[model samples]
Target: MNETPQKSQELKKVAECLYRNGNKVYFALVKVRGKQIKRSLKTDDMAIAKRRLAELREKAERLHGKENKNIRFEELAENWMESIKASLKPKSHDRRRVAIVGLTPFFKGMPVKAVGFAEIDEWRRKRGASISARSHNIELETLKNLLRYACDRGILMDNRAEDFKRRKQPKAVVDVLTRPQFQVLVKALYASPIAVASGAAAMVEFLAYSGMRVGEAREVRFCDVNFETNTILITSGESGTKNHEERTIPLFPNLRNLIQRIKAARPTADANDRIFQIDSPRGALPAACKRAGLPHFSVHSLRHFFASNAIENDVNFKVVAGWLGHSDGGMLVAKTYGHLRQEFSATMAQKMTFEGLSDTPPTFAVVRDAAA
Candidate 1:
């Protein structure tokens, strides 16, 4: 056993211990044949420097996936966010920022893969009544999308978010104002400031008359209207559309006149300029409502009003769907507005009641038959 020390046969000393900034560190350089290939296993660990280099060599030989061990979740998320930021629109990017900030606290130290259903449930439970169910769902969906991005890049093992379920939304009826109610609201808007009523009088009138979405109505420029054809083109916008496709909607004669009047009143009206140029709908809409002495009806109510009026007037559901720029005619007209359609059916039933009674033949009297 003592004879083994006779030949400490020229160990290659491939790995070396080094000191930098007074911290013990390890690095190894390996050269093979004429290639002079080099590999560095840089670590803060001095004792394990040689061992770390060997592991790296084995990993390289296997040629599996890259080893970014000790990578932080924040790092992967940051990397994924670059492309996402570029892809998202300005408003969308801002919304995503809020969602991310709300979600990050729950999973700060955890690996992306470790964020599964159990963690989501725990987070939701702890959140309690602070956030609405719909808001909670939005934040949850944002997390899911991030996980999906990681999975696509092979950075995550699985999208654990898929296992989580959304909270059920209560079936509250969406708000809609009747025609007379909306007229009262508009009167209140008339007394409000430009900041309070910025283009809303026109917006409400337009959406109610033309059945256009708020986003679509806001994007129309003066040039988009054709006086000769009497058509309004909802093709141009700063952001993409709800349906992501443009459509030419017939301008209701009344709506066209209202828009014209609004344009005439505006100091800055250009052929190519945004028709409704204001900071935000939120600024003016509420003030206008207060001044008009009317309830603050969201502009989206105009959409609901349009649907109700359409059903009442017996306008075909498909026609209403197209005017609203919905891809699914059935969903837009039938599903959400089925109750309105029932009112139409009720009107028809009234018409047939008297007619059915009159159309029936009178029965012969039993007394007359007994006398015979």
Candidate 2:
């Protein structure tokens, strides 16, 4: 009889701890040290509410007799951004700052610890609907990093955002210009009436011949190029290369001649002066492409053209990767230009013959008849 009564009292207290609000959402209300605490479990299901109630109760008991500093998500985000500011480049930092701005509105007043799968999923469904998968994934990555930061500092026991997977992105295609097409485009640029067409033409040739990024190309000074060693030293100003390290690339014949010609034109130019006068050929490049009846190509397309041309010409991927400032030892180059290699191999395969076989290769009709 006494056992039944004690169980009844316990069940009643448990029932009182959890209740449904006007919106049919379950909320956990409990008393800690004579002060009442209430939190929305953010669910309508009774089973989930009960489980969350137990977690809330345990957390409340642990935090008892201590100052409850419920830090807002925005506050923690700011701290995390500040902590990483010194380690990232300005553009990188700005991108993360933009991600934070997108995240803050959804989680403004929510406590860092209170954010869980439900809140995260809700935010994802709402946010992912409006943005591209790549953009959404960036924001999601930033959110996960912030939660992990909070966990490291003991603000939360776990990073609930850790298990959330990112959306799949589509495969990207690399477009490049053929040698003849590039020559025509350059000629068109030179023939254009634009005041900057001459400088833009030179810049276009420099990018395609040297395989340097626009940013890195803009920072190349005359002193950085060594005609004696037949090499060009790539050291983008204060920030360095994309990998933050300087590298040396062989000055190929075309690149060497282009630099020499430019130098000859500016006979009194100082070694400290930049190699290219213009930063980019954005305007001239597109107009030239249109005038030539060719596809519009950006500065990056020229870099691709360099890599494609090199691979097709039998320049090894590792060497090309070094010239392009990729830290990965030829992996990216091989992946991007593998198709070209295949085509090259197929062309070379046609010339091969067995010692006992006829030197003449089988024609398509002969192969078709044999197959039949």
Candidate 3:
């Protein structure tokens, strides 16, 4: 039964200094430094509620005379950002900083301990109106992490932000190119009058063949290639890969041939010289797609094409994930390309049939005659 506002606000004593509201959610109502403090345990489970209530009481007693209780949300957030800055990549740090900046206005002057579900809900309602769900979720996560940090430091009793659910995000559609479509695109790129078309064509082919991200491809040098071992070392500039580790992918046949062709054109090129001169094929790619009479394919589309082709060719997901610099032991690969694998499986299934099912099946006439 739904409780009226008056009934829901009424607290029933459950145990010493612990109470359950009409809705059955437990709360801690305790006194600290001669002042009454009320905090929700944020759970209905009896055991969990009791434990959280005990923890809350202990925190109040321990921080009775401390100045940590007075720390503002802005100060806590700044401290959290500073603590994480050294551990995160520059781009990642910047993203988190942006999230915190978006959150600062609503939470600025409030004490860490004073912020609760109402404040968080209000922030979510206001923010959801202006930004995409994905962006709001990022800021929401940042808020939760900041509160978690405050809890660890005893500046706040519990992370109230955890109780709020994140907004739903739209599923991403994976778009890739078939071999014929890719071939036509490359051909059009090569035939284009644009001066950078040739280089752009080379970049497209390199990404599709090597599964290297645009960033990683930009940093590849001729010296990184080992023709003897048929491997190409992928070092994405000083920052390394997205995961900050260098990986070596097999010098695939097409990739090797592409390199050799480029090498032939520039015999005097230094070993340190990068294979592709252009930073990105953005302009060239769209132009080539238009010329080829195909839909526009981004640089990332080439990466997806590589993964789709690998799955179609029966390459193991773990190996593909390794080549793509994923550390999750193929879980991400399976999630993204499992449908492609299913389509490939369906195609392969058509080749299987009972030998006797054919209209011109081989007869056992000799054996039957002998038996007769």
**Alpha-carbon RMSD of each model:** 14.3, 9.1, 5.9
Candidate 2 residue lDDT tens string, 214-252: 889989999999999999999988877888889998999
| Poorest lDDT segment (10 consecutive residues) of candidate 3 | 363-372
Q: What would you estimate as the lDDT of candidate 2?
A: 0.85
Model 3 TM-score relative to the real fold: 0.79
**Which residue pairs show backbone clashes in model 1?**
188-292, 196-284
Span of 10 residues, lowest total lDDT, candidate 2: 5-14
- Clashes (backbone N, CA, C under 3 Å), per candidate, total 2, 0, 0
- Each model's lDDT comes to 0.69, 0.85, 0.87
All candidates: TM-score: 0.70, 0.75, 0.79
Q: What digit string (tens of lDDT, one per residue) describes model 3 on residues 1-372?
A: 555987988999989888999889999899988879898888998999888888778877765246687888888888999999877878888999999889988888998888989999899889779999999999999999888888777677668899988888886778879999998988888887672434887888899999999999989999999999999999987867899899999999999999999899889999999988888888888878887899978999999999999999999999999999999999999988899999999999999987766788576754456556
Task: Highest TM-score: give the candidate number.
Answer: 3
Which is the leading candidate under lDDT?
3
